[model samples]
Target: MEGISTLLSYILPGHSRSVTADYQFLQQSWLPTMHFQASLPRLPVPKLEDTCKKYLTTQKTILSPEEFQQTARNVDEFQLKEGPQLHQKLIEIDAENKHTSYISEPWFDMYLSDRRPLPINFNPYMIFYQEKNAAYNSPLVKATNIVISSARFLRALRAGLLEPQIFHMNKKKSDTKLFRVVTRILPSRIATYGAYLFKAFPLDMSQFENLFGTTRIPEIGKDRITKDPNARHVLVMRRGYFYTFDILNEDGSIRSPHEIASCINSILNDPREPNLCPIGILTTTERNQWAQNRRHLVDIGNADVFRKIDTATFLLILDDDLVSEDFPVLVRHFLHSDGCNRWFDKSFSLIITGKGWSGINFEHSWGDGVAVLRFCQDMKIDVSMRPHFHPEEQAHLPSSSPDVEKLDFKIDDVVMESVNRALKEYKHWTLERLTTKHLLHNIFNKKQCKNAGVSPDAIMQLSFQLALYKLEKRAVATYESCSTSAFKHGRTETVRSFTEQTKALCKAIVERGTSNVNNKEYKKMMIECSKTHAMLTKEAAMGQGFDRHLFMLKRIWQKYYDGEPPAIFKDPAFTKLNENILSTSTLNASVVMGGGFGPVVEHGYGIGYMIDDTDLSIRLAVASYKHNRDASEYIASLISAFEDIERILLSE
Candidate 1:
């Protein structure tokens, strides 16, 4: 019964759900947030032959004929030999572990086993759009409101009062109060069935548990996640100093907003100069090195302070720098910062700039963008609708009970040396190699794509293919993240956007240039490419994609077999297909100004984009080591590609 609902979602495309619209109705739901967990289906594994076929198809667009033939032979041999046995073993293991998805444990191991530093390699940032009212943009006021609103969200979630996250295909019918009332009366086991009857699909809420009071603890080999849900305080960092104070009272109710504001203000105004050796910078170093330094800190009697910082409800960083109007510069700030004021190990840091511009820089090991996006969306709406502090209001002076306490670590010479080394490495790594460029193209957007009868996401992805072709005259392996949250304990799937249709479209555009030799042909190719991309996206979302299945089979071969692995795993095409030269993701929300991450590969580009009514926002980052890559040229190509796409769409 694995992926039954997911398969149905694919079969009945009209019944699929979207999460773009605001979910204010969550505040009015009658059912518990986890009511649909038990009924959610497990992520399914695709058949071995289907996995091999899909693998060959993906390689065809990027590989030469000779290379493709060699790879096909290897794949055929593996499919007939080791692939079946390994896949069968995986299925058996998955059957024994009926409580979770097949990919969950290996996925966790994949992230935890990485020895790279977390900043550019793992952590990503999402910035919120500025408030409409100028007064609400005050740092103190915004920080206060965020604290209060976040506490409300936490309380609702812990008490099972937060509405379960569901995708409603027909909001008018499925997202109504009557639907909720009917669903509340159904048994917990059948709650999902009730939702299906209403054409709403509930998402797995397991990741929500780690959205708060969670921190990644660095170890020698692999990092681990630690959560202290009972802790009531929030950790605050400013000018390289750490502070902790309670935000929730004995009754589990949020404290006075004015009090929270005052404590933050005091820390902001504190005259203590920045620490000469800020310990937070150590987290930006290599994981194994950071782990060794952490052990030293514990040996030096800083364990209690470390525990407090780890167990806090969440971290709030009060940055001294004012927000920049330049989009790329602001992205740089939110993404990694100076490394001194950011504790990159926290589950997520709510950062408020001096001018009140704010966003979240999150550690990516525990979860993906879906959970964080929901938190951001809900927080944005809550603060806008029900603000606790006004712009004209002043923070009330703190009384004897809830004063903020600054945490002081007793560090010796060795720790200071480690901090200095870490700072040097971080500065060299971030400041020297990476470059980011942003584009806000106003020529066309989702509305135009829809009016032209094409998938908006496909249009953007096709533009990427065209852009890369124009720049490099080749099609490379590209990655687009597709969420699989419709299943139990779902994470993500790789949507291989470079397809045979996309390659044809790119070749036609590049070869024809501005001539109208094949205008009708171009339009036909565009539509076909969109349809193919849509099919791939749906398959990836339904847990029927081949990437993860093949990955897990290879993992089993490596872990269980002692001798040399299968030939398919050793093929050069396999390595090239996983290189991911153009790594892309889309998160379009009313409140998100834009967001991005660093390039996964040293010479590749990491693109985060959002489609709006009249424009598209793209943030592109690359590691320009030795000036091998040009961010500006790639951005120009993207703009031209988008214009070319628009011309084809509007062609008669």
Candidate 2:
């Protein structure tokens, strides 16, 4: 068996030999960078009393007095009796695991295994518009520039030339260094591999000659990725056809933009048959479903083609031309509703449309938006500095006509049926699940927030809550993501946006319209809300949020305690308030690259807002099922709420 395993390792791309070598190389290369990962404090088990107190306070507004009293009793009993013992056990567990975060393992497991539909549920997008010098209509020119820039940035990252992300303390004088948790590798057939190998950005200058393009191939239910380590080409998807073209010079340096443009022109102009079944649509299926289908596909010869596609540097999507500046058309390409223009499983894919407007759709599993934003900013700067070529420049460029390889799968009757099903399901899912709205508010910008004596974030958070109240006529459970990346492998903590002050302000604004609003009282209320918002946000950032702490405690009780479930855990009031109706986050990125995700629950809205000095942009997603709620109408209500609040503040 060992001998067979060894023989198979020699044949497979990321098999036993590669995994062993990769692990050894990873240990040596990452040892220097793991100091912070090692030195970071363990996720602290906060005093059960404090956590219970905070939990009770969060429930006060949502629960009736009698209901609150019952929850209070349950919390008191748990804290006084079993909580201390559980805390001790959790401390012991933390002490036992010294290398990684206690929450880190479970967090990742939950993220990957949740099996939600990707289009709007878990995946987020960032769209970059075509600037004066940045826009390139030709796929070859755009893809080459993006690939080269990405390679340089990634190499700099591995070489430690780029600055590590430091935690910016809100009030403290000094910035604290955080764990650099970004990984550029995307997962492929996670269940089959049980682990993924991180691809090292080409290090040696000459090594770059053998590398060119990488791609992800979608199977019936699951998807596999491949790359050609010895090939210097990139995968291009246009009008539902796939082709590969080289992007590197013989010596490994990237070819000139003009040369790449010529290669792309030849391929696009040359006639090629479209795919029999748009297999890329299967990437749109749920993870486990895809995995099951992938098992069946292995019997076919799709594995080798997939391996070649996944080995490329990255996937570059060349969309059909869009001459109009209509925001909807640009969004259709970026978000990619039904077209076969995207392979969504890649860690990151650069999408260049016909109008030269481009953006990125990235898998959230690899890294957060911060790292991707930095890369986007670098690309923007690089494009700005690049010299544009004239029409005559193409004639003078080097003529290296590399054979553009065409990679395709053999779609039998079984595979063809799956493909059709996927296309129909994905098309309907997009029409129902993904919706976009842009708000450019002249009055509710950063300056307006300051003049109104409130933090911009707090104002926006309150506005979302207020809009929900107006629309639903009740306070809804809301979530605001607070980054805890200050700690090792830290991701996020949930900050409850529904506060006492928010509740009061919403009621007041509803009763007294903008005409009869009280400026002094409203200003005073908003100021208090701002302070409360800041305090909760600070606690969340400090790893003292209510959700994770309670989650761990419940898990501990289930593991160690032999008694029945705690009343607090089974209480209806607690369960009701815990249902997240509005999953919101303030992800501040360049306006062009800012994007959002779908709400976690079916009847909820995912709100990603960016508040600039002069304007505010919101990316909203909601399930368009049965007209439960309309995202556009909600945005209008939010706009009206902002207007009412501003009017009340300035009336005095």
Candidate 3:
């Protein structure tokens, strides 16, 4: 009989070859930048608790110091600088987050690739990995949205920061590729169509920095808000219920997106439970046949939608364990309801959060992405009543339990067949397909760069190391990788007045025929480009790094900012990008959540949220690999990040 290696060869014809390819790709392509990978074993994660504590130290300091104090001195009620052209109002509110000119050189390279003359035919590939699958309209839409912010509004925004005394608002630019913003939020379009929103406002920094076009907010200890800085109230909102699956276990359930759904399914569909609803129906526990109702299940009916009484909406494709050492994985990702008045109100809209969470938001038209934080917060609605936290519950954070041993099997025909089968047969596939990622299993990888202090490349490298660790059986978390990136808007630093506030690039995309006034800003950048090119050496960029962008945007890129010295970026002919932070959003983190779920079957919303909602939101992401590697501890880390963020904020 042939040896096991021989059988694997047959199962995976490309086995021996992939090992070389994976190494070459890593060593030549990725490792040169981060030498540790080639020479060392998988990079080590700091003791999860310690690393988390470190990350939390900064989190706790975000609003405590001088910057907060300085800004606190003269607080202005968030005044609408521009009168109500409803969409314009959204733009002004949203634009405040952006920092510089929106045009990102790399993204521009991606966009203008075809149009560019000669050898530079844009690779049409992720500069880091294989070209992202062209199948999903997501990338295209993403490109459009990114450009609107990067190219148009990002370049021309006003400068200055607003420390709102009231809301924890996160505004992002809409992809120019999406339906018109006004049309998107229209109750009509929202009622029957897709989510006009995406994984928008979750304190996502890359997109925020790019649109806002500034350096990371200096630590409060290092900066100041203004005189008599008033301690801003920390505002929390539920976004939506996220999901994951798991396998039944001994110590506890080994949940992933799939298993979570299954658990919710069993409890929700139990006829004895009678009326337990899904995540959205009850922002707070009001009605349920059983006390611990498992909401977030699935309803099999055609045109199935989530609702107040529909506990069967959530579904799980994996099993659960009896005792979990950590948070179980989530196989399924969350989606807002398409149900009648009790869910979305037939109008695509964002739910504005406040002291009293809205009760009427679960209706179909009322949803989009905006309500997730609130919806998620609502899931823990019952927690406040029983507010006391056990040590384990207190350890809660947002993380995952990615299975790591599968790489030993090789990218042989066997694995390919399983993945292919996943695409063709997986009934609940929400993402585009599993083919490309399956191939790049050894290639490009990243994680979101939350701290503005870190370099983007460093962030990507860390994510790469994490992926490697998981592939090599050393990862402590479910995330094989994360999406680490930043946005590049125009620029600015002076917050002299409201007129000096940032502009929303989305405005241009939303309202065609924008005045030439905004057009001037782009022209100015064209002029600056000539000099920017002269001064911007690739090495200098590496030095300025992502963190410096936060500061250079203020000191160096001022020309591109809304009210800076006008001629800095201007040229005689073409209008350069007028970048701004407003007018954009991305789903990289949300996509990560989806990936954690093993497969993404469907997604809803692009830019809006639920109205009259809860204060905190919960997300559940699951991963389904060939086996359930005991992962409770790793999954717990993610929950730890969340709690760390929450606790730090509370203690402050």
Runs off by more than 4 Å, candidate 1: 1-28, 395-402, 614-626
Candidate 2: tens digits of C-alpha lDDT, residues 573-599 = 767766777888765655364456666
Backbone clash count, each prediction separately: 0, 17, 194
Model 1, range 401-493, lDDT digits (tens) per residue?
Answer: 347988988899999999998888788777877777777767766677788888988988998899899999899989999999998888999
lDDT of candidate model 2 versus the reference: 0.61
lDDT of 3: 0.21
After superposition, which runs of candidate 3 have C-alpha atoms over 4 Å from their true positions? 1-370, 378-424, 427-462, 465-652
Models ranked on lDDT: 1, 2, 3
lDDT of each: 0.83, 0.61, 0.21
Candidate 1 global lDDT: 0.83
Cα lDDT tens digits, model 3, 383-481, are 222212222321232222232111011133433443344323332222322111111111111211112222223222122222223333221111111
TM per candidate: 0.94, 0.80, 0.20
Predictions: Cα RMSD each: 7.2, 10.1, 28.4
Using TM-score as the measure, name the better of candidate 1 and candidate 2. Answer: 1
Put the candidates in TM-score order, highest first: 1, 2, 3
Error of 1 at 212 (Å): 0.7
**Segments of candidate 2 deviating more than 4 angstroms:** 1-43, 134-140, 167-235, 244-267, 321-324, 386-403, 432-434, 515-517, 555-564, 591-594, 614-626
